[model samples]
Target: MVSKIIALSQGNREYVTDMRRYFHMHPESSLQEFETCKRIQKELTEMGVPFKVVNDIGVIAEIEGAKPGKTVALRGDIDALEITEKTGVPYASTVPGKMHACGHDAHTAMLLGAAKVLWAMKDEFEGTVRLIFQPAEELIAGAKIMIEAGCLEGVDNIFGIHVASAYKVGQVDCTPGPRMASADMMTITVNGVSGHGARPDQCIDAVVITAAIAMNLQTIVSREYSPLDPTVVTIGQMQAGTRANIIANKGTLELSIRSFSPEIRAGLIESIKRVATGTAQALRGTVEFKLTQGTPPTINHEGPTEIARAAAKEIFGEDCLVEREKQTGSEDFAYYSERIPGAMAFIGSAVPGPYVPHHNELFDIDENALPGGMALYVTYALKALAE
Candidate 1:
């Protein structure tokens, strides 16, 4: 059965590749995937697949087999980033300041291919497959809305995939637990007296205070956290003085915090606020610290993980499955995992060249990986439903 699904997926490679390139050429951002959703709707309609819209952008479709036993949902995020394209491919994004650098384009296209394959073979299986064309993964906001709209109401298990640029095209990673980290956004604002730079004692230095706060934040992971427990505190944005010769009155720092455990997440927030506030007081500056919750860790359930691994092994050779370290990067797919048994697989799409990570303007995937990804989805769906 798996081999048949693989053959069907390979046969439909052209359609998947074309759809991926089409999405790559015309990218849309977040909840603004108006035309993207329309295109998806049109494809499903042409395939004779049944679907309905959720929260104006998300699309949920179902493919029932000959008999119903259990339902498994396959999710594909469909939002692009606010980035300009530099890949220089013929299908490089035509939309300026927007690009599908994260491979959500490939995700959507491959899932569509899987839908086609599964629909064709529905007579052999005895359950339903739910297709989720989710939006706004870049903002980590779309999955929640889809859930609120009841995408998971009857879902027995869930599976997702992310295209990876770090490995060769045939390799896949399906590690079972705690695969991706939780993310939280932080903003630290430092306020101090302003004065001429030459008058050292006359003004409180907001720049120095902010710099101190940023450095202290690093300790939350390095010193406070166990080395075995991975965590990251990154201050990515900093803004201070307008002029080089003046002591700035205010400085703001933007930070990204990530971890796998809720306890560790709480500790990170507590330590950050403590350090920032204490550092500011010592520097005779005032501080306002803010933290906003983002996505949680994408912890894979053993059931879904085994299903993915089995599917990968059955479709490709045994060596195709690769062991991978947990990722500090965050994903909104964690939302679904939190509610139901869920797992995600990493499908390699790296080409042989200078490597570029996701969200970069130069990011591109080896299109040869599309068919394998479709096969993985279809096989996983069949395996999960059978179990």
Candidate 2:
């Protein structure tokens, strides 16, 4: 079975790479993947796979086996980052201010390749394979939208793969348990009396209060949370006075909080509110703290993870598997995994050059890695359904 899957994936390598390049040349942002969705549907149609569109953007396709059994799902995010292309490849993105910097193009292609393979082997397996071509993953809202639209209604176990440019082309990371962090957005607004800059004590100086609040917020991580716990509180955006001479009355800070533990994540949120409020109050100013909860930490289930490991070992080799530390980076795939037994693997796509991280303009993956990822998806669904 493994050999057949490998051969099938290899045979479809050019088709997969061609589709990936097409998506790369015409990249789209989150929730706005109309052309990409249409193209995906076209490819699915060409392959004779039945599919339905969900949330008006996501594509859900199914391949039922000759016999009835449990159903397994495979997801591929189809959104691109809002970054301009700099890779200089002949297939570089033509869309200005948007590029497949996060390797979603490759993901979409690999999943489509998997879909082709599974459809061809539907008679061999005894269950169903659900192929999810999701959009708006960059906004971390697509998975939830798909779930609400019933993408996981009949799924027994789910599996996803992400391309990583940090490791060599054949490596795979299938480590179970908390592979990615949860991400939540925080906003703190400080209000004070606006007065002339020359005034001595008339103005409350919201800018000063905001700066103080930002500094105090750091204590929530450094002083409140345990050093052993992985947490990050980053103030990515700050706004204050419009001019140097004028005393600003309004100041705002936008932050991104990341953590692996739910308890610590909750605690950090409370601590942030307390610190911001207390700091503003002490400075004789008022503050408004708002938090928008985002995706939960991607926790890989033990059973599905074992299936993924076994699949990787069979399709690739034992030496292809590698250990990687949990990352603070978050993935919306957590939404699906949270509801069912699911595992997400990292497929290495590093090219011969300096490593470039995701969300960067110059980020890219070696096309040679596409066949391995395609095979992993096919093998995982087969093994998982047999269980």
lDDT of 1 by residue, 247-365 (tens): 98899999899999878988888999899999999999999978799988899999899999989888777899897899888899999999999999998999779989988999999
lDDT by residue (322-370, candidate 2, tens digit) is 9889999899999999899999999899888887988899998899999
Clashing pairs in 2: none
Q: Top TM-score: which candidate number? A: 2
What would the TM-scores of all predictions be? 0.90, 0.94
Q: What is the lDDT of residue 270 in candidate 2?
A: 89
TM-score of 2: 0.94
Clashes of each: 0, 0
